[model samples]
Target: MSWSMSLTSFPSRIQTHPTIHLLRPIKPTISSPPKFPNLPTIRSVQGNFDHSPITPAKTRWETMLETAASLYPLYVTAGAVVACLKPSTFAWFVKRGPASYSLSLGFIMLAMGLTLELRDLLNLFVQRPFSILFGCAAQYTIMPAFGAIISKSLGLSPALSVGLILLGCCPGGTASNVVTLIARGDVPLSIVMTVCTTLGAVFLTPLLTKILAGTYVPVDAVKLSISTLQVVVAPILLGSYLQRTFPAAVKFVLPSAPLFAVLASSLLACSVFSENVVRFKSSIIGASLASDLSPVLCAKAILSGELGVIILSVFLLHFAGFFVGYLSAAIGGFREPQRRAISIEVGMQNSSLGVVLATSHFTSPMVAVPPAMSAVIMNIMGSSLGFFWRFINPSDSKDSPKVDDK
Candidate 1:
């Protein structure tokens, strides 16, 4: 079950289907000068393909794809903000159907699978098994336990506490790979950690949530396990199969996959927000910390109560994860880039999956709030951290080459 990413670029040149036109570099052609030196005829041939028929379209297509990829964070932020302002727009995306959230999650997972190849994964594990293992361990260990501590320390409500715990117990997100690349971190380590945690989530998410959140409410680990399998595992495996069997199609879709996943996640987050908008509005203004708590605890409680305990709980969970994850990795003797990767991976939970699971399993809309809010908060926080890290040089260049999953 080991894995590695292929060096080959997506939308590979292996086009098997007819009627699918791929843009390829046109070979350079050397033309002879005019036969007669006296009367020179100028041919409109350009070496840079300006004269080629397909150049404009190809350039435009490539630019569009690049733009989408570059603005992923912006798109996600805008979607969440807009959904908060007017939930109706995104609410419609979910209203049309049964399994809307599940289907959207499945689509995101499929896109992730298309980007992965078994050969690439195997190469990665063969080269750096320890880094991957440490990252996965951190994701499962640091985040979940810290989440419970934060929730309890804040004294969150039952639904909000459970939501925070679920957010923590969930796996690393696919988005972490994108952030790692932006941060110039260990992309391979990030991807491998994400893959490992996601697969492990079938057991870990439910088991941890039950253990941590069981105090808040009765949790059914078996039910959560089945739901996770249905949404996460099946689609990802099917997508991997399709990638191997129908690479041409996968290639066609690969360029758009990440952006598509972002959009899908945003929509899912917004929908959850919309469904609980009324409760959300009321909850935000409802409570505050009393004199019974310590000064530090009282300050956090005040923020949580005023801002809606769910948002504050989720924020503290991810913020603590980012800080502690990096500190722990640095202490473990990992280089800066590896520490960055571990931090982002640990901080960004599969929030969409959290939203989906909460919506499907819990009766309370409040339960889904933390994850939905996390979808907005984590990206902004992760992106900011990534950009900050991008300017700093890694401690060792050797660490960079060994963990480059790209």
Candidate 2:
């Protein structure tokens, strides 16, 4: 009997054959099983597997939402932790408050400027100019009006009322674009609106505040405009020019914007607290007492209790701005994305600016409460809204109607 063996390089295996008994080397024969008698003979199946179809890509809005969803928790947590630690660092922060607030404002303006492009400005002449314009109008008009109404209705003190109006009059926050993007809104449009409103605010904010807040509290439009232009417009223009001219420079500035903003805000918070401590020390000490406390302590306790009111009013106004801004956009023929953008843009005022203005001009720490508290509340509320939108939307994983931009 002959036996043969073959080695296959493809599978790296040795094949043995028992049919051949002689010592002859040859290729082995492999065959399919024979069909049973009367059974149908099967041939083969052929198709193109390499060129199979795949799911479509997600839209820009969908991508934005996913990104926002991922980062929102960190933003909220950071803001909360910072705020909780304020009391301990109060004195240090207050001493450098104005400078810190100014730095933050400058950084935010610079970031805004860097983000802007010529094409974005050209978008003003495109199909949805009215949408942008109306959105801006709604933001400036409705928000301040609501603030004024709320302040009056609540019978808040003059300082609180003016603070609310000041907050309302300020431009949309930097965070607005982020929230708008997450909500699947037109991010470019949001950015443009923010830039326009912010620039316009260099002049308009002072004018509007003087007109609206003057009735409630003393205001100096000229001084306010100068301050705003110095802190907001100048930095923004410089940053935008740098971004346009040297794109790489933005890398350094972008990360620094938030850091500066945080630092500035912390300083502003400290300044306000310190001023409050100094001016209303008696009242605060009095209010701090639990009740049936001594007169010396009673003063501190009263001031401390007033802080609670200040915090509450700030929260109320911030939330109200957010809710009203979103609802107004939705009612005004805006879709989900645009509405989200509008809501955020309207809701989150530039509270850092408000703080700076209040502290520099008002001389009363109480006046700064609305803006400082607003800064904290807006971040929390904006983050919450972003998270909620993401929770419901969940990127492009779920089926949604395709947006028709025509």
TM-score list, all predictions: 0.78, 0.70
**Compared to the true structure, candidate 2 yields what TM-score?**
0.70
Q: Which whole-number lDDT from 0 to 100 does residue 160 have in model 1?
A: 84
Q: In TM-score terms, which candidate is top?
A: 1
lDDT of each: 0.77, 0.65
For residues 76-104, write the lDDT of model 2, one tens digit per residue.
Answer: 44544554444444556556667766776
Q: On residues 1-406, what C-alpha lDDT tens digit does candidate 1 reach at each position? A: 1122433222212323323335876555655443444743332221111111222234576568756765656877787667657777866766753389999999988877777785677676776777888889999999899889988898878988898899999999888887887787767678888988999999999999999999889999999999999899888888889889998998787767777777788778878777776555454334322535466655565555535566667778899889999888877777677888899999999999999899889887778888888888898899898898888766544543233222
RMSD in Å for all candidates: 12.1, 16.4
TM-score of 1: 0.78
